[model samples]
Target: MAMLNPMPYEFLGVRHKPNLNNFFGFIYAKVTVPSSVKVPVLPWKDPETEDTIYPRGFFTGHYFSEELKAVEKLGYKVECYIGYEFSQQSLFNEYVNHFYEAKSKAKERWNFEFLTKEEAANKMFYTYAHEVVELNENHLILVSDTTPSRELLEAQDTDSVFVQNPLPQDIVGSGLGQFKDELK
Candidate 1:
């Protein structure tokens, strides 16, 4: 799917907020695993109850503060990156597949050196999913494979890209976010 480049005029016409209960786009941090520790765990604090729990990996950056503190307390390393998450399994899979195809097509069609910087970045976006990791039992985490895999419990970022306007009638149901996939 071609990327949407909504201009300033488009933003002026938008009336409703996009529902982001299902998508996540944010700055993500993951605790880096050191060779000394065979298994690394994330110390997460529940804000509502103020209880701390350790999870294998987190799905989003909502716990940025807690995570930073936990890593500092443990004397461990943490790596941050731009990440995207999808709660719905099918949507997540679709996103991964879409980017993978775009990356492949770009490699086949153009030499990276010839593309402008922005064009290179757009292509890089396609390559980011090669490191996607399904965490927290049901959610998926997307990153670049060149980086280490995430190993923390689970969390989700509330911020996301939402369609500010309605899709055409013919494409309403077929539009992005229209296809709902329940967690299994």
Candidate 2:
């Protein structure tokens, strides 16, 4: 799909550096495996304008801690991404079919709503980027042949975070603690 507003290619902090082929694997690994949350959207009615507002998406976070406490505790690496539900009936049927075939069956299937990679990236960029205050290096980065596999668990270590998984329990408690407080 064409970029809606120009790919925020430089938004990721690590994108500024040179020779990132090695990092691409790391980033892809992070994407293939994520620990995320099902954030609820509460509809709000404007008091004066009386306009209805629909909640867009849920907040999500990785399982790793600043001290790598969670990763160490869980004995693996973890990361997360956000997902949004949007209307896409205008899209071509063949595109929809192809998307369905490519996507996993973990999320609720809505005939008129679907999630896209661009939406996922925007969600993560807005919700979790500022929350990443630190990084830990104690963990070893490993390579897997099936790194692009759809099975979240198989593609990522138990410590890895994901946007969506067949099992919700894997990422129930990885929300942004301080960041959530800030939002409140």
Candidate 3:
């Protein structure tokens, strides 16, 4: 992952308009997690062209707002990169693998579609999303470890990176609010 010019990187998300039946009929997700949807193809025909089936489209934010808005809806709007960071092809792989692994048990239906060098390179919307997951059991655990081990979380390797949190509830750090306070 080589970042030449060093630009700010933000995770993208997605939003899909569910059919009238909701949950596509029959089933429903018990738990919804923030995610990014990257599908290879759609079974339905493209209404716009009236003949094509969305050839391996990678993103879909054009549906509404960008990825950030989706994340904000998830209540994780504050999550963001604090500085310039580099990127690698694997970054995308690591992302989708999460859902793949979780759904692996359902083998025939949920196994991940291994992406190729070209597919990986052909990254699409590259945005954010809120995934629907069904958790029916009594006990549930969410493992939010993005890194390899707990050590990384304890000693986050922020050597050149700094992740910023959302702004606090009452103080305006800029603009008219600051001007009004200054008047006092």
RMSD of each: 18.5, 23.3, 25.7
- Model 2 spans with C-alpha error above 4 angstroms: 1-67, 75-110, 118-153, 156-184
Model 2 worst lDDT window (10 residues): 24-33
lDDT (0-100) at residue 67 of candidate 2? 20
Best-to-worst ranking by TM-score: 1, 2, 3
Over 80-173, each residue of candidate 1 has an lDDT whose tens digit, in order, gives 4433332222335556567656755776688333455765665586477457654663233334332243333122223222243433556434
Ranking by lDDT: 1, 2, 3
User: lDDT by residue for model 2 over 115-139, one digit each (tens)?
Assistant: 4676566557658676655444432
Once fitted onto the true fold, the runs of candidate 1 whose alpha carbons sit more than 4 angstroms away are: 1-39, 46-88, 113-184
lDDT-wise, the better of 1 and 2 is 1
Top lDDT hit: 1
Could you tell me every candidate's TM-score relative to the true structure?
0.21, 0.15, 0.13
Choose 2 or 3, whichever is better by TM-score: 2
